[model samples]
Target: MAIGTLDAAAAYGRSLKTLAPAIGESTAATEQHAGGGNSFGSMIETMVSDAAGSLRTAEAESAKQVAGKGDMIDVVTAIGAAETALDTVVAVRDRVVSAYSEIMRMQI
Candidate 1:
């Protein structure tokens, strides 16, 4: 069966909802800590951990498929979700690096 655009969009929305709590918590912590550097570091650490978890989940689903015990649809969905999570993490890392570079080039 072919998936519709709405179905894909809903899946994306669900994934965003899953990440929303972490984002909110990180924001709150950053606000509470003000100039403390650990808040941003912890947020990035959490994101990387979440991405690693997604990749591990996808690997497990693929292994199940290889063992003939899992549905192809589930494998596909898990892989897609993992890919999206990894991409988000990489994008964030790139942005952070770019910002750091810009800061380093600024006049002190």
Candidate 2:
């Protein structure tokens, strides 16, 4: 299915909302919270790690549900969070790739 611009915008807003708490924080604050060095690579690494964690949580929830030990609501929520995190990671990756491609095509 074709995704409309509005849908894309809404998805971007949702992703931003998920990360709103960290958006305006200082680099030092972010580094402290993230428990790592202050750099773009480190920030991306943190994001990817968090996304992986979310996906793992979702998988665990699904397994629990399959084994009849998890609440349906919890499973659904975890899955939703995982989906959002994955979307955010994919969006960032896409932007990075696009920027790289643009740079490669630029005249020196």
Best by lDDT: 2
In terms of lDDT, model 1 sits at: 0.70
TM-score of predicted structure 1? 0.64
Q: Count the backbone clashes (under 3 Å) in each candidate.
A: 0, 0
Model 2 scores worst on lDDT over the 10 consecutive residues at 4-13
Supply candidate 2's per-residue lDDT for 25.
Answer: 68
Task: Name model 1 segments beyond 4 Å from true.
Answer: 1-38
lDDT (tens digit, per residue) of candidate 1 on 27-106 = 65444443334555445555666777898999999999999999999999999999998788778767877999999999
Q: Positional deviation of 28 in candidate 1, in angstroms? A: 17
Clashes of 1: 0
Best by TM-score: 2
lDDT of 2: 0.74
- lDDT string for model 2 (1-108, tens) is 997433454455445434636578666555453464565545666677787789899999999999999999999999999999988878887898799999999999
